[model samples]
Target chain A: MYAFFIRTFEGSKTQVELLKEKIRQDGKVLSEEVLKVDSFLNHQIDPVLMQEIGKEFVARFSDQNITKIVTIESSGIAPATMAGLILGVPVVFARKRKSLTLTDHLYSAKVHSFTKNESNDISVSKDFISNEDTVLLIDDFLANGQAALGLIDIAEQAGAKIAGVGIVIEKAFQPGGELIRKAGIRLESLAELQSLQDGKVQFVGEEAF
Target chain B: MYAFFIRTFEGSKTQVELLKEKIRQDGKVLSEEVLKVDSFLNHQIDPVLMQEIGKEFVARFSDQNITKIVTIESSGIAPATMAGLILGVPVVFARKRKSLTLTDHLYSAKVHSFTKNESNDISVSKDFISNEDTVLLIDDFLANGQAALGLIDIAEQAGAKIAGVGIVIEKAFQPGGELIRKAGIRLESLAELQSLQDGKVQFVGEEAF
Candidate 1:
């Protein structure tokens, strides 16, 4: 699938490498015991890098004519909004919890967070997405593919076509990449981590680990 | 205070008018009920417009060196992230709900949402904000000022300095604009609403509506 996108002048290998290099340089480990890059992913949104990633996603799926970019909010809004800017599309973020402001007619699905170790409800406003629209799902990270699956569920409920799913980083060794591949949806990731050992970041197809 | 910022940059008035015009033109009403401006605010983050707003913010507070841009989750992230980008600073968004991935050590505050019609908790990671940081609070709306106060409380809990607050829209008739002003803090709003009556948008000044 990546080969297809790359061959069609839709994707760039060099830009992906640049994002990986940025993740290595600016991303810092928040805790020694728990290896989490809080600076980039959790705490702050790096606009410069995020904008580049957004551009890459737009280039990769430029021909799709996406009507809306759907994402699970809190962290995903940053990159999703960036992608929406480049794609010139509206972005509808799923709320993690139900609120009075949210309409009763919502498409909801349960998402399990591996890092958080809990399951939460994710939902979208039904009016924002429609059967005539095509959606491109964006997220910050894909470890177990649960969040992506939850987003796909919402998209399906709204009867919107899934153009593709763009992820900033994917843990290749985890079940996420394989599960997404088996689901038959187009998945494009900027960085793939083959392994993590001794608090070091290792890339796929590399002997760095 | 706005005059001070306006005097620093002469031509910014044109850009401000441009934004106000964009809001009036692109903004749509859903069934004459909800103001659905998802194209620019909630769903899509307009890069050009957001950049202009960010520039206006920088021009408004150029004298102060903002160490961090603090905001709440959801709608606030877009404008805050854009401002952080132009200011070349990091943006720290307060989580509306507690997640398992977040550490227990946090600065928490309560926020009442008029749109949502409920009160919820907002928090910031202790590690992201510190005592020495100077925070510039940013939000998409300042209708009631509860959200801004929530962020300010979080910043205060971290012992961070409150440089000032930047808001995209403020309902002048509401107590929000008045409360923030009485608190003796500099409040800068891109657009001030005199009122919303008969499904029409009204501006506070003759600048634009």
Candidate 2:
């Protein structure tokens, strides 16, 4: 039972702005290609921030009839679970490893991690995802879009309709955002980074959206 | 801001009972040793139930002066993040892999997954946990206690004081519960299973608690 607050989304700094501000303040610029947000996103998480991100995701994708929230293991689980909490949907995270319990009747795809330069098979039990479900895919970061694409592949394998893709951070300089958009899938990246070059953080700018 | 409800913890089914009821209704007993709860806990998560689990954990450990909530990757991240949100603390999940950005100045521990029949070197960045902190370690399931012990080892390696350990479910037949209790740390397992033999879930029961 939630008390409804008549809070409008106008005349205020958006959740996207707050997330970008947090990134600017705490995100580590490792190089032009890498930005480490270990302080709040991946390694160590700020739960309040995650909850805010979740709300933002739900607001952005509210139009879609999302029956389930699908995400990859580890980082994606936090924000996905949070959004699933608010939306009253189940969250399924695809495991990168072949766990002993998950033996058969699975929908799986190979996700190539560009950072680690290795391919890992990510899987979802067939019992979780099905053709009748319209799934909203979520992830912490979208770089080359390998993980997102892998999720899409898995969802398609189950003959499920994809509602959209929600990403916490999207590197605009990379091909991920373009690829997803070109594929005619709805993609919402909360903080779209233009560049992490010159040991500085640069956003794609608010007007670009 | 939350509306304060002074609801007493009496004259109602306990959080543990609710969790056990859900388990009994949905859990699949693969054998006497394994109870698959993928429908709600792991693989696929029930977000509302996870939030309840989080609140119960916070209520149980509210007096511990906890500064951080720590857990392993994947399954543990969801419930741990939920607890972190309620407690106003950071949830630091130890990475099961040596990620590219996570190279140096780390606290590492080897966790052997009996299910996978393999060992993974789980690591945490040195920047997260410290001696000044008191961490509450959380997990979805406690079987052999290998994962919990590994977390304790990592937290101890950083000189962080162990406030307590919280588990969503504990196989009372397993050594994990006893091992943690013998170490003199407060252990709160929401649902304790007495047995899963012959494909039936038997709880340790409310009177035992």
Candidate 3:
């Protein structure tokens, strides 16, 4: 039993390391605050890598009893759907609209995009989520956490229980990570970047390597 | 050999029928031209159904020497990603931008959304697609064919070979299907809607039922 446990843990570790290696190879540092992974994670997606990512998310949140997977539209859809496939749950993506105010028959929240410097209303249809749901929130990147907070707000508006927030990449230096943990929400990030300064990636636990 | 062919054909037909049934059951017709599949297609996604879709796209487009899968942002990402997972190809989604004119370092095309009554420039980084790639274009809906044309335009701009176009649902009454076919492009739509008059869906071949 001990041997089996060790093997499983090692396997998990290797899979996650594969993701980090990909980020190291193909990921480009655009600026001190911006890292471009458009070739794989967002714009051009590697399906095999995304499959591994889904498996990793399932392994981490296996104990959460998640009923549904929620994410924001466009980039978040691929990873969220992959996780939903493994979890056997439906995935819902909040639509970003140009509207600044609430609309009828929708659970809405205003989310500001720091990168784009714009505020847009993100909304989910009222018919999809309800109070009975226990949802797992997923996104590609966690920077300022504005999008995550918006999803959480919508879930709260619908009275749905949040299992946790799963992020593929987290800027460890950003206030978003600290703010989420302080709120007592279980947050799991596959990769945590300590810094993106000087056109380099310094992952938060890389000193051990 | 005969039985094997029959079995494969029957299996493919049943899977396509499943998608049509889902639309007939949950699809809401807001008007003559609008069908809301928010419950399972765009806003909320059914992973199991999407898996079947992925398999089906592979089955149909297996003959095309497809090296890449191209799709538009938002709705098309889920199904396109699933297809990419099966085909072992990288999926690239065209990011919709507000810019009207061509931009630097990207292949851009103007696509007008008839549903929203607006125009947006869809772009893909020049680094993603090249002359060596034989790309299969996929989308959730084919109405006016503007988006599909935009993708084809971008692919041509990148000098990529066009393998084919795959669509989840096609409005048969609309001119998009005819326009694409007239251009000598192979267009495969899983479900075709003949009419949605009086809030009732009429699939093109439903009379056989």
Candidate 4:
């Protein structure tokens, strides 16, 4: 696998700054308040970059004995998976949409997506999480704290210990980061954008933790 | 990264057989036609096994000069990303539920999920796929041809060549596998189960291809 895909990626790179550069360059400023990172973050993914982001997550939360990584469906799957791969932990993603084949016995929570402007119920199989496990919630973006809180709520319902939340990008100006911080839950964001004004990204820097 | 999670897995392991064994032993058979592999395939993932599955995809589609790996959202992402890592190609997954941030410029297709008993319109950003790419479609399961055909239809819309379709499990009894093969597509399933009866899995064997 290594022999197949190997290239010079500047050997050492800063996860936070690289993501910010991607947002500034490839990101679309839909509005003064919104930034779309579809090119690298969501719609079109850079797997190699995601692997780098995943490694950064493991490095940030190296001390926590994270037994399992939890996240919401779709967007969170990629980065969360990369972390799962590096951390050697199973990733249990909460499903936003339940298929007809889904078991009735499950743990579920209502999550509101600020971006989508809609609230949806997300569920996880009861068999996946255990009381002895420590869960780290991860997602692509943290806005309004809806999805993260929802995942944390689900983990709590499963009686799993809350390790922390690993976010790829966090809108520091938004209440999500503040809310998670106030709750005394550990949160690590690779890139924290303080403001998305006039299409320029303001890094939250060391204060992002 | 590999050093952090490396454990001795027999290097000569057969990908197809291992997956079949997983389905037979751990897979939940809800009924005659339905098999739930959510424990490992979806809800909670065994990252190590997924890595092996990914390597096998790279092995099978080692030729055809695959430039990109594609799949519909959620379940397909993990294995596709793994393949992306080994093959050094970018992995792109179609989004099932569109976030409000998504741009209107896109190639979209409707897919019917037999398990979900619903039809969803999955879309890929127009910027991701190009006419030059040779895409290898990967998925956790290939039940009905709906998802694959939908993705292929989207790729054709983008004028991208279809390299092949790699499925972890293919229900040979269903029309999905047959449909892809009839369309003169290179279809590779790591484990093709002919029938799942009374909690037992019957393989399609090498004759499946």
Candidate 5:
């Protein structure tokens, strides 16, 4: 079994429970007009907290032979870079749009951003990922599986091995975590949210969704 | 005089010459079918190299009393983050697109990317940059000066004081640097390119551009 499987199956279930509680306490609920986490988790908050999340991810997947840590650009780059620093690996972020620095020959995949309510092509330079690479995909949030699937497609096109997916927070009520589990790939999440009820964030294994 | 300005004015002449020699040795020529890097000095390559170039930037601007390192994102975030880390200040990257994560109230500006051949609306959350902030603007390239001007505008909107502007590589042949200089802003660049000859990268002084 994978290292995360050991932790999730046999290790501290109470630790996970504590983290959920911490998230509820630390993460603020914005106005009902705003999304659930317009402050800490998603938008503007603490970098130190994010770095700790990165460390937890590194510990969870310490057994995997990860080559490159892949993440989408912007917010994901911060946590991914932190994880890369811990693992001593290079962090390659997928670009939402093509730029001059990017190579012409690239592995391209389409991703739908539920937050933006739009679709865009994400790409990685051909020179960045090699066939022998074992990739650890990292992201801040996983509400839907679309972005992760797009990253998987890019990794496959480059012939890189998918070691596993590491997420800081996963909306367990959503289809994202379920889809990755169904794919038979190991998925490790630091925190899981059951749902947002009446503008308050709730956790799974405790109560309502 | 700032150490960066002193070093740039004195040390950069030699560094620019050295960079030119390196580029001539390592730089590759592109077919018309491929993207040329001349526009890259102003447009494409500038933003990508921001992070790598930021190490030198921090050393130059080390004496400044900077509270936060700010940059208009989608491009400027790279160097801004690196500088933030070195300066021990929080780097706030302005968002290029509205997402579910953002609040309705924001300090917004419109920046035109010459390379992408389009204009984008950029914003920072009100909670990020405050009136008490002393910001150092970091950008990859300084070309026509619109992007930098837009960032300055955003900083002003937040009532933040401007410490200075840090640029990775400046295209001295263009009016961007000259304009910023005329505005009396402290603009420091690691490498300044005088011109491009037959796809060859040329430097302003003796250092690499």
Candidate 6:
């Protein structure tokens, strides 16, 4: 059994610290490269805690008039939906596979998952977002930024203005953080992990949360 | 654009009636066999409407002392997470595809999606549920009972008590409702559709909800 309350950072009291604590305690680290939060956030979810993560995202991006929040299918839907609830906005997730029921008119983009070693097309209905909409993109983890870029591509296709991006955990060790910042997208990550050294999780921008 | 009623169902009569109204108005019928609620529920999610759906679910299953709300990954995560928020319990979704980070210890099940015309292995981390758990399964739609049956099987594998089955929409024309009811599962669907015929959605037990 995983002891979920083990705090890694003794004095760091930010949401980032608490989140890192949860990861260190409950997250299953299959390898030095793969840190799975399936026990708490993705596969096995803690909604009450995730809802707090949502409020934290809103707290960070409250100044922006985010009319809609968009995320990719599967894991992102949980926290992003919660953020939509806290923000009083709607949430739309891009479908990874085209369903028989989905309409033909859609904004499609290609996303390559570095972790999965696979590439696929993700799409959103053309009618869900429009030119007037200001959308915030949110996701569970940002590693390679392929999925977030796909979301950005879809939002731009709909002519919607990019409000910002919210990420639950950012692997700053990867290119996602760099690419997003390089693109000038206003991105806020609740917990940013700098490295996983000898089964220990390190952090970036500790004071910024 | 999909018109999201900026009213987060506030001052709305009740979740059931509001959900039905939204379905009647915004739900699309691509064919007699296909009824798509992508505009509001599945594809483009309305957080306020979904939150109310969660509350209505809790009202239905409140007395059961549900320990965990279980769902399949992807679309089910949205409403299930909200229900967890309302119930103040944790949520767990079975993963459709095994990722590298997933643990080898798991309860596996095969689910055939009637919509997708594909069958794959869906598994949940064995640690997520146990013999003491009373699990409640929630999903976006119940047409074949195949998916829910898979979940039930997984719960049973964990020796967890079956609290009940909750569905957002049930295609009554299909055998899913009867099979679940016949098994004596306390099956509750917010909206039960009798048929989707001639570009129309017919409902059974409408007034009861």
Candidate scoring better on DockQ of 1 and 4? 4
Candidate 6 local Cα displacement, residue B129, angstroms: 1.4
Give the range of the ten consecutive residues with the poorest summed lDDT in model 5 chain A: A1-10
Categorize the docking of model 6. medium
Segments in model 3 whose C-alpha atoms lie over 4 Å from true places: A1-13, A100-102, A207-209, B1-13, B100-102
Q: Which CAPRI category fits model 3?
A: medium
Better of 4 and 6 by lDDT: 6
The CAPRI-style docking tier of model 5 reads incorrect
lDDT of 6: 0.81
**Model 6 fnat value:** 0.88
Tens-digit lDDT track for model 1 on A41-97?
667666656666777888898889898888878788877876776665677788786
Docking class of 2: medium
Candidate 5 Cα misplacement greater than 4 A, ranges: A1-26, A30-45, A97-104, A205-209, B1-55, B97-104, B207-209
Question: What DockQ number belongs to candidate 6?
Answer: 0.50
| Candidates, ranked, DockQ | 2, 4, 3, 6, 1, 5
lDDT for residue A175 in candidate 1, whole number 0-100: 84
Q: Would you list the clashing residue pairs of candidate 3?
A: none
What is the overall TM-score of model 2 with all chains considered together?
A: 0.92
Each candidate structure's TM-score, on Cα atoms with residue i matched to residue i, is 0.82, 0.92, 0.93, 0.91, 0.76, 0.89
Q: State the displacement of the C-alpha of residue B13, model 5, in Å, after optimal TM-score superposition.
A: 18
- lDDT for each residue of candidate 4 in A1-209, tens digit (9 for 90 to 100): 12223242556667666676677788776765677888776877778788878877888888889999998878888888878987778898888863324547788888877676777889888888889999889999887998888888888998999989999988888899888888889999888788777666677653311
lDDT of 6 by residue, B87-120 (tens): 7688999888633345479998888877877887
Candidate 2 collision pairs: none
Q: Write the per-residue lDDT of candidate 3 for residues B14-47, one digit (tens) a residue.
A: 7688898889889999888988999989899987
lDDT of 4 by residue, B49-103 (tens): 7878887888887777989989877899888887887777888899885332444
Question: Each prediction's DockQ?
Answer: 0.32, 0.62, 0.52, 0.55, 0.09, 0.50
Better of 2 and 4 by lDDT: 2
Residues A1-209, model 5: lDDT tens digits: 11222222124544455446557766665632223443434444343444456667778888888878888867676667556655656677777863334446888888887767888888877767889999998877788888888888889999999999988778777789988888888899887777665777766666642
Candidate 4: which pairs clash?
A: none
| Residue-by-residue lDDT tens digits, candidate 5, B95-152 | 7763334447788787776666787777778887889998888776677787787778
lDDT agreement of model 5 with the native: 0.66
In every candidate, what fraction of the native interface contacts is reproduced?
Answer: 0.49, 0.91, 0.88, 0.75, 0.03, 0.88
